[model samples]
Every structure is written in C-alpha cells, then in structure tokens.
Target chain A: MQKSTQAGFWKKNQRALAPWFFMAPGIIMFLVYVIYPIFQSIGISFYEWDGLGPKTYVGLQNYRDLLDDDSFYTSLKNNVIWLVLYLLAIPAGLAVALFLNQTVAGIRLYKSLFFFPFVISQVVVGLIFTWFYAPGFGILPHVINFFTGTPTAILADDKYATYGVIAAGLWPQTAYCMILYLTGLNNISPDQVEAARMDNAKGWSMLWHIIIPQLRPATFIALVVTVIGALRSFDLISVMTVGGPFGSTRVLSYFMYEQSLSEYGTAMGYGAAIAVVLFAIMLVFISLFIVRMLSQERNA
Target chain B: MFPKPIAQSGPWTQRAYKTLLPIALVLWLLPLIGIAITSIRPGSDLASGNYFGMPSGFAGWENYSSVFKNSNIGYYILNSFRVTIPTVIGAVGLSCLTGYALAVYKFKGNLAVFFMFVAGNFVPFQILAIPVRDLTLHMGLYNTMTGLVLFHIAFQTGFCTLFMRNFMKALPFALIESARVEGVSEFRIFWHIILPLVRPAMAALAVLIFTFIWNDYFWATVMAQSVDVRPVTAGMNELKGQYKVAWELISAAAIVAALPPVAMFFLMQKHFIAGLTLGATKG
Candidate 1:
C-alpha cells in the first residue's frame, strides 16, 4: 500500500519536479562560482584585510583613497580611452568583411587567414606585437625612425604606450567583428541587395542605406563585445607592459590585479574595492544587454 | 551581391580587386607573419642584425626543441589540456540540462533565471577573482588543476547555458508535445529526442569552450601557482621572463602555446563560426 502511494506521488509531481532537477546542478555551480562570489567580493570591499590577515571593518576608506590617488584617475582615463577607441573595431571589421566578401579562388582560405589573429591567444598576440615594437630590432619603431630620424619605442613611452596596446588589441578584436559581420553578410537577403542595385544604388549610399541596416544585429553584438573587451583589457596590458613605463598603461582591471596579487602589495580589501567599482560599471552594460535580450526573447 | 558582384565589373576592376585582396591579407597578418618568420630564423641571423633579411638557415627544429628542453612548457601545455578538456565536457554537459529545462519548460521565473545566466556571463572576472581565490584556498583546491577546472566549468556554464538555451528554443515544440501524448518520460524524451538534435550545438559549444579555456590566462594565474598546475598562458609569461633575450625561442614557445586553438579553429571552422556568430543574426 505504501509503495503504491509513493509511486502515485512520484507520478503526480514528476512533470513539475523535472525542470528543477535538470536546472539544479547548473544553478548551484553558477551560484557558487559566479553569482555568489559577486556579492562576497562586495562584502570584502567594506573590510580592511591583506590576503593573509584578519579583516577589520573600514567603511569607504578604499574609495576615499581612490579619490586621492593619481593612479586611480590615470587608470580611469585610460579605460575611457580604451572604450572609445575599441568601438573603431566595428567599422574596421565591416570594411574588412566587405573587402573579403568577393568570391575569388582560395577566398575561403583567405578569409580564415584574415580571421587568424582572433583564433590565436591574446597572449601570443601581445608577444607578437612586443617583438614588433622592441625598439631597434622592432619593425614599427624602425619604420618610424626612417620617417622621423628617431626611433620611437611606442610601448616604452607614456603618451603612446596605451595607444600601442590598444592597436595590438584592435588586431584580434577587429577580426572577431569581421567574422560576425561576415556571417551577417552571408545571411542578408540577396533580393534586397538586387532591388537596391536596380534602383542605381551603389557605393557609399547603398552601404549606408541597405547594407548597414541589414547588419544591425551584428553591429549590436560587436558593440557589446568590444565594450566588454575594452573594460576587461588586462591580458594585453599584463603581457605587453605589466602596467609599467611609469604605470602609464594601467587600466582598472590591471590595477586591481596589481593591487591584490602582484609583488608590489597584497591589499585584498583595496583590490576588492577596485573590483567592486569595475563591477558596478560593468553592471550597467550587463543590464542594458540583458534587457535587450529579454525583449528579443519576448518577440521570439 | 552588395558590391555588385565583381564579375559584373570591368576586367580591369576585377583584376585590381584580385590583386588587392592578397596584399590586404598580407598587411593584415604582418605581425603574425613576422613572428612565424622569427620563430624559424637562425639565432645567428638575429645575432648578426639580419632580423628582416631572409633566414640564413632553417632553425625551426632547434628553436622549438630548445623551448621544450629549457623549460617546463611541455608539462605546462599538458596541464592546459588537462584543465581545458574537462572544462569543455563539464560546462557543455551541464548546460545541456539547464538549457533544456529553461527552453522546454514554461516554468515561472524562467526569464529571470535565463537573464541571470546572461548577466553573470558578462561580469568582469575581477569581481569574481578575489572571492573565487578565497573559496579555492578555503577548500584546499588552490594550486590544483581540479580547482581550475571546476571553476572554469562553473563559470563557463553561464555562457554555455545562454548558447544552449537559445539553440534548444529553436527546435520544434511539436516533437515534445507528441512525445508527451505517447506517455514518454521527460528525461527519456530529452535523452532520446532532444539530445540527438542538439549535437551540432554541442560540437559548436565544445570547440568554443576548448579554445576559451585553453587560451585562458587570468584564472590560470589566479587559481594555480605551482608549475605542475599552471597552464601554458601563464607559463608563457614565465617562459618569457626566462627567455628574455632569446626572441627565437620565445617566438617558438608562443607559437607552441597558441597551436592547439589555431588547429582547432581550422579543423572545426564551420561550427566555430556558427558558435561565435550565435546572436549576430535574426535576433
């Protein structure tokens, strides 16, 4: 009798219970690793602690210190520079995609080769650029020297260091956006293009009115990723300059890592504070993307 | 079609376009081409200030072998595979379940749950880094490959779930309804029906995650310390420091470190692009 009753309960509840069961492991893992850590980091920011020490409550002192620190402002300014310059990848990517959109022999190989930088690790990209800008032996510096009668080591100078890293970063980022646009182009309605052509639309006007509108979805994604990439610009900085040349290349992400983990110091609370600020900035973008995706889901 | 299909243009225009394509590609890949050449150039060529000149002789074997002989790079790359493969399987496997639940079920808070994953996917690693490190240390998993793998799997599930959920959503809902009418259990329906259909997505997710985790540097540095567990990206930095002046060897090591993902991209070009351009069209 009890066995039958238990079976009845199972049969009745299984439909409802099934989804939760499927979702449980993923949710729990995400909560543990990704979600909960967010709040914990926020909590840690309010306390003073070296990585190895006991915590003491110190409300807003880190943020207060940030206000007075020049490095903080420098990092913030560089992040703004990164965000603005990174969006150039979208238009640049579209240009490359258009250039390679032709149906020539071996164009498939050429397209993939053009997308090669994005496939390789950024660490490798950074190293490649490092070798390219290594002063006397580096190619770019030599070219500049030929033009100006003085070799300029771009990564070593304060004014050009951030720009140099951004340029290296743009190589892979532009490739990423190019692939996105390529896929978008492949999916575009050929009839629409033919119609536009029949109307004598050619050159910049056709691209502006027809092709650009069609690539909206690709452009949206390109913007999201490029923005995120700019804000998360750590690997290139870490690999290329290690936030050096008088700390001119420091961004918020690298600054946080340097504060908490590097040999210079291990101020965990301060690092958490920096991370919280970064998170707050990212949250704004995250919310915007999520809302857009939510609307798309509803329409779908 | 947009550019009026070069075949319709004059022969001179077509010839100009054909000539321009290779030139543009060459210029675009100049840095990488430089690195590849430097990797194979004889050390004496560099020493003799012949950096840009044609190579004196092929030293690819010597430079690549010396990188292996002089450092723990081989072990580091092995550790990378150890961390990356398991992450791909775990993240993709777990997401297959979560994605199905969210996509097929009309439960309350489904949108909220889905958005949570999406938002979590985009947050900066810095926010999670300190606490995740703390958690790993407390669990005595720090400096272990398992620690890195576990964290990667958990974190990647966010992105994987977003991908899988969207993919599964595009499937025919009638299949599930018909199965329900036949009294098929939900688990069996997912296993016997949905799983087979999503193989393309699984392939796509697998290659993408493999590359992401393989190329990962931040977590490798934060979570693993000892050379035994450090993956190649972090190890590449260490190798760079060790090989400060050996541009040839450093270039070789960088190429070796980047080889697997590049090979994977070429091998799985179709699914890789499909995965990357997931929401770049239609929605």
Candidate 2:
C-alpha cells in the first residue's frame, strides 16, 4: 500500500519536475557565463595582475588608482556627453516616423530605405561616416568649404571628434528609434484620434496631447536602448577614431577595453574596476526598469 | 490615419507629396548611396580625387574579387554563420521551455526567475567580459568559435526568455488547464499545445536573433582572437587596417560583410518588426 502511494506521488509530481528539467540547460549556461562571471569580475577588480600571471589581491588599490586617473575623467565626461546627445535620436526618430507614417505610393520602400542604416553593421556605418567626414576631399569638408570658406577637419579636431562619432552613431540609432516609433504608430487606435479630432484637437496640440501619449511605450523603449547603446559606445569609437585626437572620444566601454586588452594595456585589475563601475551605473537603470516591469506583471 | 493619409487630401497636395517622397529618401540615404557607388568605382577615380563625380570605370568585379582573394572574408562570413545559427537555435530553444514553465506552471519562483532574465538582459556586456573570458579560458574554450557561441547563447537567453515569457503569458491558459484536468501530462500539453501556439514568436525571434548575432561586433572582437574563429565584423576591421588605401576593395568587403543581415531583414521584415514591437504597442 505504501509502495503504491509512493508511485502515485511520483506520478503527480512529475509534471512539476518537468519545468525544472526544462530550465536546467538554460539556467546552467546563464549561471556559468553571466551570473557567476559578474561576481568573478567584481572579485577580480580587487586584485592586481596582468591577464597572464598569478593574480595578487591588493584590495582597493586599483580603485584608488582610478581616483587619480585622468583618462577615467575624460572617459566619464565623454560618456556623459554621449548619453546627453544620443537622446536626440528619440525626438529625431519621432519626427521622421511621423513624416513617414503617411500612406502613399511606394511608402513601404521609402521606410525600408530609411531603415537601411540600422540593418547594416556598425563597422560599415563607422567606415561610411569616416569617409563622409574625411578631410579636404570628403563631402562634408567640401560642403563646409562651400558654405564657410574655411573647412576644418572635423575628426582631427579634438573638440569635434567625439561629436562627429556621436553623429555617426545617431545616424543608425535614429533610424532604429524611427522603426520603433513607426511600429508604435501602426498600433494607435483610430477611434482615439477620431474622437480627439471631433473635440477640435489638431496640429501640435493633437500631437502633444493625443499622439505622444500613445507613443509612450515606444519612447520608453527608445530611451532605454539609446541609453544602453550610448553607454556601450565602443565599435564606432574604435573603428573611427580608436579614441583618438588624444583619446578625446574614449567612453567607459572603450576605456575599459583599452586598459585590459590593448597592446599598451596590461592592467586587467584596473580595467575590471572600470567595468564594475559601469555595471553599477547600469544596475540602477536596470533595477528601475525591472521594478516597472514587475509592477506591470502584477497588474496584468 | 492620425496624420491623415495624403490620399484623402486635395490633388495638388497629393502631387506635392509624391514628388517630395523620392527627394527625402535620396537625402536620407545619401551616405549609403555614396558608399554603394564608391564600392563599384575604380581605384583610379578615388586616387584622382574624383569622389563626387562618376567613376572612371566600373571595377565592381575586380574590387569584389580582390576582397575575396586578399582577405579571409569568406572564412569570416562562415564564422559569423557558425556563431549566429547555433546561438539562435540554443537561445530560442531554451527560452521556449523556460517561457512555457513561467507561463503555464504556478511555480513559486516564476516571477522572480522571469524578472532575473529581464534584468540580466539589460546589463552592460563589459561587466561580464573579464570573468567570461576567464571562465572561457579555464574551460579551454577561449579564442574558439565554441567560446563565442557559448557566451552568446547564455547572454541571449536573457532576451529570449523575456520575449518568450511575454508571448506565452498572452496565450490562453484554458488549453493547458483543460489538458491538465483531462489527465493529459503537463510536458505533453506544453510540447503539443503551448509550443505550437508560440511558433509565431519563435519565428520572429529566430529572424531577429539571426540579424543580431550576425552583426555583433563587440563580442566577436573580445572573444575570438584568431582569423579562423573571428566573425565578419572584427575580420572586416582587421581587413580595413591591412588594405588602408584600397578603398574600393574595402568597400566591397564591407558590403559583402553587411549582405547577410540586410538580406535577412528584407526577407523577414514582418516577423522582425512584430518581434521588436511586441511590448511597445501593448504598453
């Protein structure tokens, strides 16, 4: 009788066990690659070592060195600049999306053409922008010469290099945001717009009050992606400038990479510290987003 | 409709709109158009500072052939496929089960696990870089395609899980509940009922992941060191360094490297957009 009861219990609990079984592979992989490494990196930040040799724990020394590091400040400042300027993509994207939201002959092709930049790899984007901003013979310089009569090399100039790279980033990022907003526009309820129109809402007032509200979700996502992309701005900087014109364009991501992996860099511990700091900053936003999502899940 | 379609407007306004569309598109795509033209331009034209003018001759074949001959671009493209296909399959397959579990089962840690996936997805890659590299090295997977694929699969699980769980959540629970009441096994119900329902989501994710993993530059650079394992993005960068003045060949290589994702985007545009806009519209 006890054996039969045991068999029955096993049969009943089998379904519940299935999820755990299903989850095992993905969970184990995540733990190995992502979750565990996060703590390991944080731990590595306390030790000083080149990647090759034995790690020596010198607690807080690496962080202490970062306090006096000029490059860190430069990277931090540029990151702030990137974060601020990159957000322009949201508004710029909304404008383009709104303009393209109209139905006409061959509008689909036009939309796809506009989105072409985003689909291409960023290395290609970087190359394209590098050529665009190339000195003397490049189109931008020629255009600047046409207007200003004194064409400056935009990328070679320390003041403009970071901004130039940011603009290149914006080209693709704006298109990405535009696609998101376009999708959002497709889902806007016609009833709401018609009702608003009946209430004499039109032009900027209609956009500000009605359309914008409907686009909040897209805007939120745009903001999130843009912020993350800006903070993680490495490829464009690496390809276009290599954080050049005296490393003026060095954002934290690139700085961390340069410190850890570059030919001149051997300070893995210091690089880990920078990575930890970046992670900490991102963690704040991640927590907020999670909180919002959790609340939404609860309400749902 | 919100902006009011041009079809509803006056004939003059419609004519004006029609004329404006091509001009705006041309201006918007100027850089890409320029690159496409430059890719086909003969090296002599760029040497002569004739960048803005018509090419001296179309060297499209020569440029393309040189890129293939001079570099390991073909190998890099293969590497990209190797990394991307496995990651898409592994990540998406894992998510299906996890999503089903979160959606169907009334487990205690369901929400917590779901949130963990969502949160982890958003963190910076650099945070995981050193330790991931170390772990990969320890496992003797470093600098191998397997290392890159493993990391991508694990990292992408966070995203796939979020998408899968959300999609599964919207599915009608009645099917699962009824199956359970009918003494149908949970595993069978998930496999037969819930899995079929989420095929659209899977298709969408597959296409999106294909594009993402294909275009990934950062992890490709960080994880893989040698040309044999390096993906197209990093390979292209290295090629750019080698062929400094060979603009035509460089352009050809860049175009070649970009082709797969662009093709994927065009072919799977509907599913791609559907996947991207999954949460945006509802929120």
State each model's CA lDDT, in order: 0.93, 0.88
What TM-score, to 2 decimals, does candidate 2 have? 0.98
The C-alpha stretches of model 2 lying farther than 4 A from their native spots are: A1-7
**Candidate 1 chain B weakest lDDT stretch, 10 residues:** B1-10
Candidate 1 versus the native: TM-score?
Answer: 0.99
Task: Name the regions of candidate 1 deviating beyond 4 angstroms.
Answer: none
Choose the strongest candidate by DockQ. 1
Proportion of native contacts present in model 2: 0.70
lDDT tens digits by residue: candidate 1, B52-95: 88999999999999999989999999999999999999999999
Residue B157 error for model 1, in Å? 0.4
Which of the numbered candidates is closest to the native, going by highest lDDT? Answer: 1
For each candidate, what TM-score against the reference? 0.99, 0.98
Candidate 1 per-residue lDDT, tens place, A1-300, comes to: 999999889788878889999999999999999999999999988888998879999999988998898999999999999999999999999999998888888999999999999989889999999999999678999999989999999999999999999999999999999999999998889999998888999899999999999999999999999999999999999999999899999999999999997766588889899999988988899888888888888897
User: How big a share of the true inter-chain contacts is recovered in candidate 1?
Assistant: 0.80
* lDDT of model 2 at position A221: 88
